[model samples]
Target: MTRRGATRNGLTRRGVPAVLLDVLLVLVALADTWANVDLGQQPAVSCALLGSFALLLRRRLPLTTFLLTVPTAMVSDAVFATLAALYTLASLSRHRVLLACCALTYAIIDFLPWPWSTLRANELSGTHNVVHLIYAVATAAAPVFLGQLVQARRELSLRLTEITEAREHERLLTAQGVLARERAQLAREMHDVVSHQVSLIAVQAGALQVSSQDPEAKRGAAAIRRLSVQTLDELRHMVSVLRASGSRPTELTPQPSLADLQRLVDGSGMEAELKTDLPEGLSPPVQRAVYRTVQEALTNVRKHAPGATATVRLHHVNGRVEVTVTNTAPTRPPLPLPGAHHGLLGLRQRAELLGGTVTAGPTPDGGYELHLDLPREGAG
Candidate 1:
């Protein structure tokens, strides 16, 4: 069952026992009053029995129960049931009706016979009956006041429960959304791993054709390379998702920026010259995009141009940050690398996401260059 439904069912199940308890208590009180009281003795006792029965519907029809018990309290010894009804009404915030009902109960208890014996004594002695009337009024008011105060506390508790439930539901939704994004990312990672292995197979086939002089081997190698590249292009989007998602942190943490650029270069274990004039106060996303751009550029040069020397430049000017990576041509012939050539594409996607652009190609002086320009403000 849904949470609210379960809560309501729980209330009903608990309420049944409480209703039975109230009926039992009211009946016991009536039996005690019937044995002792002597005011309007017959009518009072019969009406008290009827009013106690009315208490059964207190939760469902509190007003009806109160109306039935109030008249009975005037003549009957059923004051206990009437007082219970008054409290129920007050707790429900029915102050206006309770005022009228309480006024009548006070008048009945004071003017009508409290027990007929007291009324007869006051009549015979000609006493003012001041103390009894005052006592009766106070008795009527006590439970109503208590009920109102208790009702305020109950309402406050209910409000707090609702607020807590809403916050918990919101947290659940947020966690589900994060899990969904993570699953999409994991799928992409699997694709990249598989595609890179296939690219290596294609690369080895090409190398085999070069080393051997057999025409059949050459033709097979050419076919493998062509088919592998085609498949890579077809699954380009999935590979792109993997390349971008793999760089992200799975937990909340400070994102990498230009400050981390040197660490990135050093971690690669590549001998490359680095330069930086990057400005401070860039947004986190822009910083991450810039850092990833440079990182991808260097990694690509290492993959495609082995044994090449590389130079990286970072510049900040006119509310924009520009990073460029340039590398000299490899002295040795190109060797097959287990990379899918998707790094540059991922960099392009990241830069564009920040409303920027990336340019990468072979340089004129027997080298390759990758350039990225990102604006600092409104770059989200």
Candidate 2:
């Protein structure tokens, strides 16, 4: 069963047994009172019946039951009154109700005399002895004490349940937060890769327009368009993989790795020089992280550094993979702009999630540098 269903079932199981026991107690108390009081004693028998029935519903209506049964028991001297008072004092909704019930019970029983009064000189001491007062007080007080004990136990159980539920809620929220962060990182990656491919298509398409007479140029432009379209389809498929969870279907997929770094270098065409030193068999996630870091770094170089030559370096060392991309600064400084840099921030966040780090800043030799590190397999 689900957790909620199991909890509810457990409560029902515990309560049903307690209710049955209470009903049996009521029956016993009623039988004993009826046997003790003669049928001629109308007031005592009526009181016994009222108090016994009240015990049956004490859990549901504790305060009312206590009030109704207390007065009748004092008059009739019935056992049912004692039991009902106990149930009320222990199980009532609040301390105020319990206190009120206790005071009312004592007042009712104290006012009524026992089986005989001192005024009747012929009456035996056994009929109106100190024992009657002790018995009456003990019976009335016992239920209240029992009720308090039960209340304490119930409160403890409730607090424990609240603590358990809070922890479960926190766990669920943490999982959802993690999933949201992963989705955002994926979006950033998709933007970088897809934008680079689309930019190539646009550049090639523009060249074809200006050099319409050159057949070779037109053919190259058409090829770039087709390649961009194919890559877009694959990008969509990868995004689908992210959004779904199940057994993955195998296919001939061209996932970018160190080999593809050459293509990117060629595409940049001397805007930057790419030097890679990847191990023989890196995990797919590490490979992807490496490829994305390079792509984003180079893209930034193209946009910000312009004519400034940049160098890309990667190496595996000391249970970690390190990447450093450095580019010489331009002779003239660029103007500082206002808006935040989301691209680099997103890249750093992605790196941190993999237990890695990214550092980017100006170098001593009038150049900009970005460094990244990914923890090696089994080095967590």
Candidate 3:
């Protein structure tokens, strides 16, 4: 494509007035030629008249104007004077090919000899002749100076446009980065909260199935159903807070912590012993992380080693929190479960985002152990 086609806004109506000015100038020169007047009294004024008519095409064919006007310039003083002025304006017009042609034409016409037979005998003397020559030369040079000025202005405009686009792109990237981080954080939190609640629901559902005729078991199942629905509602509300602008819900009811470990284990239909060393007024994020670590560890134990006994421990240190869950090994090594544990991956993400870590492995004592450590009092 042409360079003009590649630009976002190519030569537009902004050039219209300048072109019209060139047309008006040509008409003025034609009128001066018709008058029998010294610089005005030159013989055969048609050469000067034709040069002025040529100015009307300055915008589209500037080089043509430069080439046609030169040889005929010596015939009429008026034509010679007008050529210089028109060349200057053409330079300012910002058409490089035309400007270069003007320079070449000027050099040739000023230096090369004209045939003696073509030189007309006219009064080539006095202040009028000197002024005419000076005006012509000045006009010829005008395009060079104006072309440079126009080029400088275009370069400055291009630089400004580039700077503005770069800043806008950076701003968009920053916004997208922040939104991604927020969405990841939200996913981790939802996994922790929902999984713990679902565990309780599962236990209650199992009880309702096995104790078919027991009134107490049925009531427990009903309570479990109601609480599960309430948990779902709370989840929706919290998600709403995460999505909304200018509002955060830190005052929502506190989530479960290490204190809930015994309940979680007992609900799994497996007996568990708790050994905890927790601190008072622990930050919410740390407590949530500790609870999730134990919850997931117990869940794996229930699914894979149903008859195994489990132990949960929470250790609170000066600046960090540690939690461990272990279970007695099944008669056979636990087989892999069919569906994936999205919860386990979420637990790890939760801990890591808060500058914490987790480890899980088979124990030499024929058991499985999972451990987590997280910042206790700071940003985590």
Number of the top-ranking candidate, with TM-score as the measure: 1
| lDDT of candidate 1 over 1-380, digit per residue (tens) | 43221224324335655645666767765775676456466776667777778877766677788888766777655577778877777776546675667655655664567466655554634345666566677877887787787777776878999999999999988997787678677766657686788789878977987987998678657766766775676556554544454366443334687788887776543568889877788787887887788778776776778778888898888988888899999877776868776887888888888888999889898899989888876354
- The regions of model 3 sitting more than 4 angstroms off are 1-231, 234-269, 331-338, 378-380
lDDT of each: 0.72, 0.68, 0.65
TM-score of 1: 0.46
Q: Model 1: residues >4 Å from true position, as ranges? A: 1-16, 38-40, 95-129, 173-380
**What local lDDT score does residue 47 receive in model 2, on the 0 to 100 scale?**
75
Tens digit of per-residue lDDT, candidate 2, span 196-246: 767677677766746788865665466566556656777767666654433
Of candidates 3 and 1, the better by TM-score: 1
lDDT (Cα, 0-100) at 191 in candidate 2: 62
Ten residues in sequence with the least summed lDDT for candidate 2: 1-10
Root-mean-square deviation of Cα positions for candidate 3 versus the true structure, in angstroms:
15.5
Whichever of 1 and 3 has more lDDT, that candidate is 1
